[model samples]
Target: MENKIKLLYMLQTLDLKLMDLEEEKGDLPGIVQNLNDQINELQAQIDELRKQINEHTSTREQSNLDAETLNQRVESLKKQLYEVRNNKEYDAITKEIAEAEENIMAKMQNAEEHDDKQKELSANVDELKQKYESLQSELQDNQKDLQEVSKVHEDEELQLKHERDKIARQLPQETLVSYDRIRSAKYGKAVVPITRGACGGCYKTVPPQLNLLLRKNDEILHCENCGRILIAEEIAAEVNKVA
Candidate 1:
């Protein structure tokens, strides 16, 4: 292999490693965001449950007040019955008393139902609070792990970047520019292999002559269709063996 070709091969290996490291690090932020989202969802559920309990309790309280007032009105009507001036007045009082008694019964039934609903809602809120506490603890633990992973990867990321920069410097400016463009176009995989007369990246067929030229490793070669640098099958097999 020519010296420049060897350098390119070395650069390719380094480039692949750098890509792996960067891709791994990129997912950390998302992991952190997901953890935060889970925590927020749990807290929101707890808050919603508490609000439900509060509304139920308020309804129950209002029902109780109305029932109390209706009872007072029924008592007042019963007292007025003793002072009726005529048959018509007595009949009127009796009707008023019956209506007030019915209103009290209805209010009592509503109060009882409201009490039961409040109890059910309160229990539900308590259960949700317990779950929210557990989720909070879990989120704390996940955040700690995320921080530790970030710290560890920071050093590994710096070393990979340094190595990548060193390899980039060894190539000609024109080659590096071309590599950058291809890396951008090919999703960070600028160098690929030619295997069985096929482009490894795009899986497009290469001519037999081009495949032969790739095997020699005497000059820089690219897949005509994808424009990605192509390594020979022999080199790839050796890499696979070592790996």
Candidate 2:
């Protein structure tokens, strides 16, 4: 139990050091991540608009081709009108001509509609692309700033994390889980040593009985007020020296 207490303290120390290193970078990481998300959303929108534009272009092309075929059919039907010998035959040729002309008009109208939509989608894509570029530029700047700050603590932070992992592995799974939970709840401070017979985290006075038991380091104990684990000052000092 005493060994477990010491290991937890060492783990907390390494974790705290790692936290400090990350804090030195300020809000650059968050800013860069936000910019990246914005750029990605904009890119997706641009891609969708481009796809719509392509579909519209294909529809317009097909409409134009259909209109051209109808026009040719109308011309052929008109030439057949001159060779018709009976009134019935003449009427049929003229009817075919009229229908083909009507189809040509419809197809041309459809082409015009698709062309207009294509132009609108193209404009939207251009607008989104500009926004994407602006966000991408901002992301690059923030990323560069974050990179510079991270580079300063890169090796030290890695070393601390490696040490933390080792110490954490030495602790029981239940103890480690509780420590992590408390740390997350209490702003990255899971274990604190007693100071002047008081809780180091919340400054609440420790009861004499609990303080005495803490010195034994035989069991995990938490502060009633802040719920952070309490350790003996002597154990903290010893761990600090070797950690």
RMSD of each: 7.4, 2.2
Instruction: Report the C-alpha lDDT of model 1 over 82-182, residue by residue, as the tens digit.
Output: 99889999999889878877877887788788778878877777886787777677677767866776687687768767876776677789887887788
List the candidates' TM-scores in order: 0.60, 0.89
Worst 10 residues of 2 by lDDT: 1-10
Winner by TM-score: 2
| Residue-pair clash count for candidate 2 | 0
List model 2 lDDT by residue over 1-243, tens digit each: 437777888888888888888899999988987888888888888888888889999999999999998888888888888888999999888888888888898999999999999999888888888888888888888888999999999999888888777777777899999999999999999999999999999999999999998877568999988999999999999988886
Query: How many pairs collide in each candidate, listed in order?
Result: 0, 0
lDDT of candidate 1 at residue 107, scale 0 to 100: 73
Which numbered prediction scores highest in lDDT against the true structure?
2
Residue 22's lDDT within candidate 1 is 55
Give lDDT per model, in order: 0.75, 0.88
